[model samples]
Target: MAAPRVSVFPSPQELGPALAQLVAERAAGGGDRFSLGLSGGSLVGLLARDLPAAITGPATTGPAAPARWLLAFCDERLVPLEHPESTAGAYQTQLLPRLPGPPPRVLTPATGLPPAAAAEEYAGQLRQAFPGDDVPVFDLLVLGVGPDGHTCSLFPDHPLLQEEDKIVAALTDSPKPPPERITFTLPVLNAARSVVFVATGGSKAQILKRILEGGEEQPLPAARVRPASGELLWFLDEAAAKELNIPVEKHSVL
Candidate 1:
């Protein structure tokens, strides 16, 4: 596995724009369609605030628009679409309208269905969206790490962590709220072209240090997120990086 690139910013204010710029750069780089996997949390606010500006700003040139992107949730709470905890709903209301063009193709789980059925249906959606690949390799996946070292709905010591066969799995015992969710398994996560973990706040400091520095026998969910042949990155603010002893690139505009 390749070592992750760590970048620390002065604060979230600085981090947000940098994150948006990185997204714009990746969107401009290659194929006709760019597939992006999104994990919700504070990341929604950050991307909602900056991504639109980054793509529409006068400084931006080329075809870096979001119109051709395919956005999928890395994990989604099985709740009503209008529910406050729904990741897909958050982006629909907060970020989608802000973009300049028509909009990206977004893949949202069928929340009205039971958890197991939702997982099966969503996996089918992924297969159709990304034909020819046994496991869809996203162009980029933007993720976040919880204070407990969890990412997506996969919590510490959870059975879902052992999942390998399913590209997406459902869990009713998530340590976090809502009790149920569907998430992309390690196979899909590890096959991504690039994975960027954005973490901020002092509350995340200790876990960040452990995830970045410690090499445990049973790695934390966040730590287990090593993309097989893809780039892994950690975008942190100083408060989140305060406890880290590893070398990190201080932020400068991308």
Candidate 2:
């Protein structure tokens, strides 16, 4: 398939509003529910800010407000919620309190399990949340690309990239610290209705160029994310888009 639409912003500040607008449109559609998969990274903080501003502003509203929005982690470190590394914990600290509601349904791995068991338990939670024909199609999945071109917990040259049987897997030897993690497999990630990769920093510029221009699927885990029936979006800051061979535009302020 051809490369998905790529949008470059001068800064993450510009990207935030666009992300908010997209989420608002999808949520307003009034599907059975709006499911979102989130990643834990610096980008998420910006997303947290943008999301509330988009939904809470003085916009015209009808009786049918968006309801039943669910949030899940695209991947998480198998640590307790209190742990500094826990993805869910980070979201709670950075994004949750800003929103108006109690909180979106957050699916987290069962605590006190061994690494492998914790991952399995989380996968089971996903299955239960999205069962049989009712498998929830994610309205939006926010992701971050690591310096090594990894997305979620899937890393460069990791065996999980080749996994096909399971929708989620446990990683015991991640190149990054806090090796133990639970991550959505390619199949599960590709099933989303929309996938947006939020990558910033000059450190990622070269890999971003390679991923977009090289065109060949390499060892980079981020390259494996291809939504089967959904739109794929890349939200890149100027530094991250510097090496890309495509023209970019600055978003006008509203």
Best by lDDT: 1
Candidate 1 residues 1-254, lDDT tens each? 89999999999999999999899888887788889999999999999999999898542345686778899999999999899999999999999999886788999899999999999999999999999999999999999999999998889999888998999999998888999899999899999999999999999999999999977888899999999999999999999999999989997544
Task: Name the regions of candidate 1 deviating beyond 4 angstroms.
Answer: 57-62, 252-254
* Per-prediction backbone clash count: 0, 0
In angstroms, how far off is 180's CA in candidate 1? 1.0
Largest TM-score belongs to which candidate? 1
User: What TM-scores do the predictions have?
Assistant: 0.97, 0.91
lDDT of 2 by residue, 160-185 (tens): 98988777788889888897888888
lDDT of each: 0.92, 0.78
Give the distance in Å from residue 227's predicted Cα in candidate 2 to where it truly belongs: 0.8
